[model samples]
Target chain A: MLAAAVRLFNERGYDATSMFDIAESLGITKSSVYHHISGKEQLLQMAMDRALDGLFEAADEVRALDVPAPERLERLVRRSVLVLAERFEYVTVLLRVRGNTEAEQHALSRRRDFDTIVTDLVKQAQAEGGVRPDIDPATVARLILGMVNSLTEWYRPRTGGAEAIADALTRIAFEGLRTE
Target chain B: MLAAAVRLFNERGYDATSMFDIAESLGITKSSVYHHISGKEQLLQMAMDRALDGLFEAADEVRALDVPAPERLERLVRRSVLVLAERFEYVTVLLRVRGNTEAEQHALSRRRDFDTIVTDLVKQAQAEGGVRPDIDPATVARLILGMVNSLTEWYRPRTGGAEAIADALTRIAFEGLRTE
Candidate 1:
């Protein structure tokens, strides 16, 4: 039911999508939707939480790893792309949250927390001489995550799958674009 | 006036912002706004076009340069970041267009054209042995542009300025993130 709401919200703008539309797509009455979920806002929150929870869990697992800082960072990026690809609809909606409602505002705040976590990891990686130290860790974090987040916009599972995209992202991000 | 509109639209969102709010913010009458532009939608269109024009012009200038493919690609990325920072609000509004309206749909198509232009440049660079050929050129293009485009979300003119960010982006993008 949440999946149907996400698809409808993604297909039509969240503001444009209605409870009636979600119910219709799910082959249930509006009352059924109300019985199952509090409201459309609740559904949006649930979907965003689903996506954010996956990312936060991945970050935690990577942080718990005994690997070096750079390796941990790499794993986080790889895992993020994989999670995003696997939960494409959820993450897509999560990324597009513009803070119009309380739920979206919560999602935005949590997204920033996730960014700070990545930034701290980047700083650690730089200090350990794994990642480059010249650029500000925050900037590096934003750029790296930006590259990963962009997957939500253009990635299609049919094209190359998550592993292929993840490999390309890790390679391009860690290695320079130059042939040398 | 359009600058003010772009700022307001960026802050309050395009749908929420009204012509009256734009006028009130500008300390002008609503009639004065109508005298200059058709409506709020026109302001959005004008602002987006301003951004797209700058990008297209930069691409054209870079293409005309007699530099190597790698250098050409670098210049395009550098110039794009600079333009994005300089025209921050316009580009911000431009990037957020979701194609709900005719104007937005037009912006989306033109944005795709710009992406194709950059992707072709990456492909040429790869064929010329300038960029690494390991990843597909299209994927490379998307990642690079994604890194650059993320600037709109967090960049502040009072912070590093356009030149500094451009230099950092060029260095990181061309030289990779890992320290040798």
Candidate 2:
């Protein structure tokens, strides 16, 4: 049901999509949607939570390893891209949220928390002389996230698998597009 | 009126923002809006065209220069970012279009033309051994664009000026976020 709601939200903007639309898409009654989920907001919260959970889990797994900060950041970047490709619709909806509702505001806050984790990793890498210290860590984090978040815009599972895309992004983020 | 419409479209989803809302926001009658523009679709096209015009102008300026391909690409990126900051709202609306309407489909096509131009520059840079040849030029173009287009998400003219942000981004794109 959440998946159906996310698809509807992605197809029609979330503000334009309603509980009735979700129910109709699933070939169920409107009340049936309420039976499982209280409302459209609830479904949005659930979908965003699902997307955030995948990202946080990936971050946590990378943090658990005793790897150097650069390697850890690379692993997290690769995993986040893979997670985004895996949960494309949910993440797309999350990224598109404009904080018009409390549910969306919460999602935005959680998204920032995820960003802070990456920013801190960038700082750590910089301190260890693995990353360029001249650039602002926060800026680096945003640009890297921007690159990864862009995958949601054009990625199709059929054309390029998550691993291949992740590998390409990892290479670009660390090694850049220039060969000496 | 188009500026007012772009703001309303960005605040409320484009599908949800009615012509009446735009009229009300601008303190004008709906008839006044119709007198100047055909309808909401016309406003969307105008706003997107404005944004694309800025980017294409920047690209054209760089292409006209006799500089090397890498320098041309860098100048284009910097100028494009400055243009995005200067015209934030129009570009934001341009990026968020979902290709649901004829105007949006046209906007998407123009956007792809812009992307292809940048991709060609990347290919030229690679041919000159200015950029790494291992990654696909299309992928390099997308990632670089992903980094630049991100300015629309969080950039505020009052915060970091366009030049500063552009400098930071150029450094990251060329030298990367790493230190030897």
Candidate 3:
């Protein structure tokens, strides 16, 4: 039911989709849909939680490592890519969020918290002489993660393995495309 | 009028927005809007054209430059960043397009053509021994431009100059964020 709701939310904008539409799509009564969740808002919150929780869990694991910031950043990127692949629909919906509702605003705030984690890591990497310091840490964090987030747009999990994509991303990200 | 339409489309999803809402947003009657354009679809086409044309123009300029493939690729990236900064709104809408309509499908096709240009550049650079050959050209192209297209989500032109962003991107993209 949640998957069907998310699918509808992704295809039709969240604001445009209603509880009745979700019910009809599922071939179930709207009250039965209500039995599972209070409203579509709850469904949205649950969907976003799936994506955010996966990301935060990855962050938690990477943070526990005693490795250098750059290495941790790389691992986080790879793990996040796996999370994105695993929870494709939820992440897609999360990325499309515009923060109009309370649930969306909450998700947006969590996303900011995630960005701060990346930014702090970038600053640490720069201090450790792994990342370049000339550019702002915030910009570096955004661009690097932006590349990862772009996967949600074009990446199809069935087409290729997330591991290969992650390897390609980290290689391009840290070493760049230029041949030494 | 088209600008207002694009703004509305960006705020509200294109499928959800109506000609009436657009006319109301502009403080004009729907018929008056029709006087200028046949329908909202035309406005969408015009807006997408603004972004696609600018990008293609930059590509054409870079194609004429007598430089190595990698340098040409760098120049195209820089120029494309400027185009995104200049036509921020249109590009934002263009990036959000999921090919729901005829205009969107046309825009998506043009976007693919643009990607092919970048992919070809990547291939040429690899053949010239400037770019790393291990990674696939198409993946490299997507990741590079994906970082750029992300500017639409967080980049506010008023915050900083596009040149600085371009320089930072190319530097990170070429030499990478890591310091030797």
Tens-digit per-residue lDDT, B18-85, candidate 3: 99999999999989988989997898899999999999999999999999999999899888889999
Tens digit of per-residue lDDT, candidate 1, span B73-178: 9999999999998888899899888899999999999999999998999989988987988888888888888888888777986675788778878877888888
Candidate 2 lDDT over A4-27, as tens digits, reads: 889989887787898899999999
Model 2 regions lying over 4 Å from their true place: none
Q: DockQ of each candidate's interface versus the true one?
A: 0.68, 0.68, 0.78
Error of 2 at B46 (Å): 1.4
What's the lDDT of the predicted structure labeled candidate 3?
0.91
Backbone clashes in model 3, listed as residue pairs: none
> Which segments of model 1 are wrong by more than 4 Å?
A158-160
Q: Which digits, one per residue and each the tens of the lDDT, describe model 3 over residues A23-54?
A: 99999999999998899999999999999999
What is the docking quality class of candidate 3?
medium
Model 3 RMSD vs true structure: 1.6
Cα shift from native, residue B17, model 1 (Å):
2.3
In order, candidate lDDTs are 0.89, 0.88, 0.91
Docking class of 2: medium
lDDT of 1 at A107: 96
**Candidate 3 ranges with C-alpha deviation above 4 Å:** A24-27, B24-28
**RMSD from true fold, candidate 2:** 1.8
